[model samples]
Target: MAALLDSVRAFFAPKNDDAFLIDRENPSDVVARECLLDRAMGVGRRKKSSEALRRNRVPAEGLALVARDTSGHVIGTVRLWHIDAGITPEGNAVPALLLGPLAVDADHAGKGIGGALMRAAILEARKHGHGAILLVGDAPYYERFGFTTEKTATLVMPGPSARERFLALELRDGWLEGAAGVLTASGAKMLEAPLKKAA
Candidate 1:
């Protein structure tokens, strides 16, 4: 019996040191992700500048991801949205992704799940050909993942935002260099107008 239990541990432990697995977010994870975000970030998070860019826009393809435990319950979530990070000094638009609302279930705090989700999301973004990613987050926390305040200093947010919290990571060298102006949503809109009632 002890040998059999050891075999089980060996099979699963190497894959994820934690009991959680990171997967692309599916339709089913939406509700759980929202509840988890609310519990972790509070109801007031919707007012943040990041939320403004995310509102009515969909995440970049395969860039929305969630972390699920062995039981298949979403315990963490992270998403990257298409955005105009800013404008180049040459009067050209700089394209980048917006990473935000990354949250872990309150009960699952301290499990390193958020970091895992960040890594997974960044990997997916790179694989999909994104050049850079921007976010409003703690410098120390995101810096470890290659995010830096230096890259976003000249960029602006559509709504109010703290300069210190605006962070960025360039997947390609010089991606954010000379980037200026306000960030804007450049993703596919969820809707152009509210659906009309049946006549």
Candidate 2:
């Protein structure tokens, strides 16, 4: 049991990679970022509820980001999608952002790279006037970044998800107040190229 306990501790421990840099994802990084995500989230990741929202939808401009090592290989990635928080009391859709698939390569896990990516994404979201951000993640891990169940208690995803893992962070106070119902894609459809098969 000692070995198992050690592994568990290691999983939660932060492993910092000081040589890494975070920046906006560029066109050339697509293949690397997709590979990194597939490695981190596994092949089944394409079926997640977040995937449903992101499929065929372009990420909000300037919000898709990547973390790269000194060698320029993509090591981490996070993208935010434009979504509507259903309809509001006034019958207009509330604009919001959906955060997802924040993936870090397994070899780079335990480092604070994930946290750094989260901070950068949030900062960019706020700077662009995004009011709220929704994601499905561990409440314990994400709570430190101001994401909580308090404002998301009434919000629902388009598909199945653990209620507690469904979370939100308000960039503008009261952005989610009185909001309820299914989250829907609200951006222009994107034309994604088919991922090339790996050798």
Candidate 3:
């Protein structure tokens, strides 16, 4: 039992070499920043780039994934937000991880790196015991990865996007069977602080 626990701890422990691939603690790292910039350019739709950055910080210890090229320049990035996954309508708890800001450099868009980042994020979330993931994005693109709008029918979000746009994916079978009101506790606090300041 002791050896198993130690092995599990070592499995998720960060190594020096991880600096080249990703930095979960410091999203503002030079390579990470460049990857964000590259993605913004590639998407060519910057309407929510700033807001996305703020939300990424809204989580506790933002988990950042960075992709680098042969020359060691960061070319892609993805992030996961920690959220409450609030209680379901049936009174069951549902903890979730919110996925977002998945971006790849314009030069690296078609090379499958973005997909790799998504897979990594999902696996990591499951390993950490998260029940589900919620996000707003295309159906066709994310469908291939088992993401669906099934849970959106029960979960209520703050935004006004259509039902199809908001999606969820259960990390385990029946994970979100009766879950609802999935929102980040920290995100809610951060958002409230800004509103208070504005008032």
Off by over 4 Å in 1: 1-17, 192-199
User: How far off is residue 62 in model 2, in Å?
Assistant: 0.6
TM-score of 2: 0.86
Q: What tens-digit string does per-residue lDDT give for candidate 3 at 1-199? A: 2322232232221444332233242434565654466557554434542234335355524345566654566766666776655676777667677777677777666666677667767766776677777777889999988899987787766544567877888888887777667354444334344344555
CA displacement after TM-score superposition, residue 176 of candidate 3 (Å): 1.4
Which scores better on lDDT, 1 or 3?
1
Clash pairs of candidate 1? none
Judged by lDDT against the true structure, how good is candidate 3? Answer: 0.61
**Candidate 3 vs. true structure, TM-score:** 0.68
- In angstroms, give how far residue 53 of model 2 lies from its true place: 0.6
Write the residue-wise lDDT of candidate 1 on 1-199 in tens digits.
2322232232222445457767778888888988988889999989998999999999998788777788899988899999998788789999899998899887777877788788777777777789999999998999999998898888999999889999999999999888899999999988676788998
Q: Relative to the true structure, how large is the alpha-carbon lDDT of every model?
A: 0.84, 0.84, 0.61
Q: Largest TM-score belongs to which candidate? A: 1
Q: What's the lDDT of the predicted structure labeled candidate 1?
A: 0.84
Which runs of model 3 end up more than 4 angstroms from their true locations?
1-62, 90-93, 182-184, 187-199
Tens digit of per-residue lDDT, candidate 2, span 1-199: 2322232232232334445667778899999988887888889999998888999989998788887776788889999999998777777788999998898888877677798788888888887899999999999989999999898887789999999999999999998888888999997898778999999
Per-candidate TM-score against the hidden true structure:
0.88, 0.86, 0.68
